[model samples]
Target: MKLINLITPSANLAELSSIASEHDLLLLRQDAVYLVHKAALPFPGKVLALESDVTWRNITLPASIRAISDAEWVTLSANASQNLLWS
Candidate 1:
């Protein structure tokens, strides 16, 4: 899946809500936490949210997002297009 990540203040969610609608996925980040507002996972696949060097247990996200610890499985933004080409 191709995800568009935006690091904006929590107060900006109102203004950035349109961007979330345009992208296939949306990742909102503030401080050291990540919130998954939308996920474009293929059927039968899963979405995982991982944050390195930070404690994300208190972060609130949709139940659809699966939290993970290891970084190896997280998809890199740089390789997203390439991965999608083959998808």
Candidate 2:
């Protein structure tokens, strides 16, 4: 699967958000964490939030999305063949 790692809430992601490929996965952290609720991710794809970032912000996200730790981040990176990072 393609791992979409977003570090910023850039307008550039508008086009990428519509990509609903089954092979896509989305991970948000840093400033991009603000898009947890507002940004649209790929359909039928798993969306993960950085647990540390979420906790630090004290923001609650939708129940549908998973919160992953740094260890899990490495695991996810290991599984994906392609990674697209946006800032």
Candidate 3:
């Protein structure tokens, strides 16, 4: 499965949703952690946000999105078949 990393709040959600499969992992990092406050997320896949970033932004995460540590992020990326960054 693909590890899709979205690093900016302005990243194109339409394009992401179109290209992402249900089995892929969507990782929200950097400014993209702001997306957790949105009413809905576009991608229909497992969603994870950097815990450090979320805490830095003081954003409360919903139950749908998991908070992962940097080590976990590294592990996920290493295990995925492909890693894609969206900025």
Q: Write candidate 1's Cα lDDT for 1-87 as tens digits.
A: 455444433435444344333334443333423435434333223344554412444666567765444443344554454232110
Predicted structure 2: clash tally: 0
Put down candidate 3 lDDT per residue, 1-87, tens digits, no spaces: 999999999988999999999999999999999999889989988999999999999999999999999999999999999999999
Index of the highest-lDDT prediction: 3
In terms of TM-score, the best-performing candidate is 3
Error of 3 at 54 (Å): 0.5
lDDT for model 3, please. 0.94
In order, the Cα lDDT scores of the candidates are 0.41, 0.78, 0.94
Runs in model 1 deviating more than 4 A are 30-48, 53-62, 68-74, 81-87
Residue 27 Cα positional deviation in candidate 3, in Å, after optimal superposition:
0.4
Q: Give the C-alpha miss distance for residue 75 in model 3, angstroms.
A: 0.6
**Of the pair 1 and 3, which is ahead by lDDT?**
3
Error of 2 at 73 (Å): 0.5
Model 2 accuracy (lDDT, Cα) = 0.78
Candidate 2 per-residue C-alpha lDDT over 1-87 given as tens digits, one digit per residue, 9 for 90 to 100: 888888886646647767647668888888777777775554457778899988988879888788999999998889888877866
Indicate the TM-score of model 1. 0.39
Regions of candidate 3 where Cα sits further than 4 Å from its true position = none
